[model samples]
Target: MEYRSQGYKTKKCGQTVLSMITGKSVTEICKLLNKEESTSIIKDLKPFLESNGYDTSYKKVRTFEDIPNNSIVLLEFPDESLNGHFTLKVDNEFYDPSVGVISTYNKETRLPHSYLNFKKNPLKD
Candidate 1:
């Protein structure tokens, strides 16, 4: 998948990540979630992905090693108010919506708090 940027001072990381996964525009994702721009609907993410033919699983982890090679990771930043950020990891590459592709988790100050693993459901395909 291509890297999608949230742009400067935007809280559309969730929307951006969803767009990257679904090949939908960020505006379309916001409308799907019934949300305004910059507002987070992360709580609705799992149900949306599942409904879209994706088999999804969510888990918390202590280290980057605990995260599977290919998954969507929610990284928690030091800031308490902002919701977690999402990034796609495929093998050794990290596709961050805010930045471009990164090789290491250390490049992000945020820590990997949890992850959502997803793959297309064969039955739905």
Candidate 2:
């Protein structure tokens, strides 16, 4: 699912990850939790996944070496300094919700500081 961040939906990046991982639409998610704000969506994500039998965790990624494709990492963009946004990393490219396209990871764009890698899978596994 391709989601572009706008207005008060600052946490749309996390929403994008959830949408891709769960194959659920934003509208469905909103109805499920009765939440319309991005911050509320993000805050309720972990519990929602947990209740659905998914185990979740966060890992600090200092380098790009150990991270695999389709990994969700929280970071901040050049313009947004205070907020930590989330995006899915596929190969050397990133699918960011804040932006409308996939961006290549390079020196000029550079990775964000203090990344919190988001990971989730089935609890039964």
Candidate 3:
């Protein structure tokens, strides 16, 4: 019954998912384990699966060839800070839609931009 919050967690949630994944619940599989948060502690976790989880950081990357000129390459660092700007260089200017740089549309809401919406059968919002 030990749990640490903030950023990462150190706890062992009863009812293991590993055995379930492999189709085997040995009960003794993780009898004396203190698993990290990445593993499922399914019962007592907040916001179970985050639809929009973000984290960034400001890092002084080495003078790699990817650093661009004139324009700034705002990389989403590991610590989730959107306050600073980064300048990465590259042979040619490329557009990376995955990083939320060049998106499909500009929305008024904070997140889940227009391009990120996945359409299924047929339901208009």
Candidate 4:
């Protein structure tokens, strides 16, 4: 999967997920969505993806076992000062768009984040 950083956008999590699903660059998505000074809103993202044929749902994953394989997950940090981050899970590997790094989910307690409880995929799946 392509990893796009949130960069200057407040909704980097949403933007990265959209980029992964739509195959669009972050800049292109910003322009396409007319997001000039801000970023895409998480709530607005659902309809857009749904219109494009992705079947999406959301949930707050309280435990490590709640995460599903081969899916894009919003990793929410407990700190309210920082915007939550996003990660993509492909099989056993996890990708962080912020740094474009891939790592294994080895049940590290320091993970410090849980799934945002949001889920979505192509309806045609």
Candidate 5:
């Protein structure tokens, strides 16, 4: 996955992550989510992905080990609220929209709080 920067500070992370996953521009994602710029607490992400033929499952995680490889994860920054950050994880490497590629979650000083697992539905694909 390509790294995308959240240019609008904290508000754009969700849009940026959606862009990375769907190969859609943030503007397009915003339109799809019926927003002007940001996504509302990720409330629309699962439905949007499902509408696009992606099978998605979301759940809270207690530790990094609980996160499956190659998934979208919500990380909590030390100074941010729970599920305050969104990024992609593949093979233990993070593709953070706020930053860039990171080797580990600890390196970014973020805690993995939950994850969203998505795969293209075979029937839809």
Candidate 6:
């Protein structure tokens, strides 16, 4: 679903994730999607997705600390057993370059093709 955020910009899927990922307010996201009721569009969409064997829902925690920076690594893929493993890389240098392994069972090719570059906070020491 598409949504407006804070007035100046628009966000797609913003309404669904406003409560997630960002963990912040999404007043505009709610208005744009026109789903201000107790139930959410995401809830309706889950079953259709699951019926097709694509589990589009909450996942296990995959943190940025698991990977490194300026790296050309070929680690064993994630979300296997249900399918096969795939490769991932980090290009967004500002933060710790890490990506959550995409589930192959969710795709026909069983190959991963997307990313969410995250940074590492090393100074936690």
Q: Largest TM-score belongs to which candidate?
A: 1
> How do these models rank on TM-score, best leading?
1, 5, 4, 2, 6, 3
Worst 10 residues of 1 by lDDT: 35-44
- Best candidate (score: lDDT): 1
Cα deviation of 1, candidate 4, in Å: 2.2
TM-score of 5: 0.85
lDDT computed for candidate 5: 0.77
Better of 2 and 3 by TM-score: 2
TM-score of each: 0.86, 0.61, 0.16, 0.65, 0.85, 0.21
For residues 30-121, could you state the per-residue lDDT of candidate 4 as single tens digits? Answer: 66666633333355455566656566555556455567765556554544435555676655556666556566544433242433322444
lDDT of 5 by residue, 47-94 (tens): 788888888888888687778865788878877664367788777787
- Across 40-84, the per-residue lDDT of candidate 3 in tens digits comes to 222211112121131112223332232433222333333444432
Deviation from native of the Cα of residue 53 in model 2, angstroms: 2.9
What are the Cα lDDT values of the candidates?
0.77, 0.56, 0.25, 0.56, 0.77, 0.30
| Candidate 6 lDDT (Cα, 0 to 1) | 0.30
Candidate 1 displacement at residue 60 in angstroms: 0.4
Q: State the RMSD for candidate 4.
A: 4.2
TM-score of 2: 0.61
Global local distance difference test of model 2: 0.56
- Candidate 6 regions with alpha-carbon error over 4 angstroms: 1-11, 28-104, 109-111, 119-125
lDDT of 6 by residue, 35-120 (tens): 55322223522332233333333222233344343221222244543432213233432111122323222333233322222222
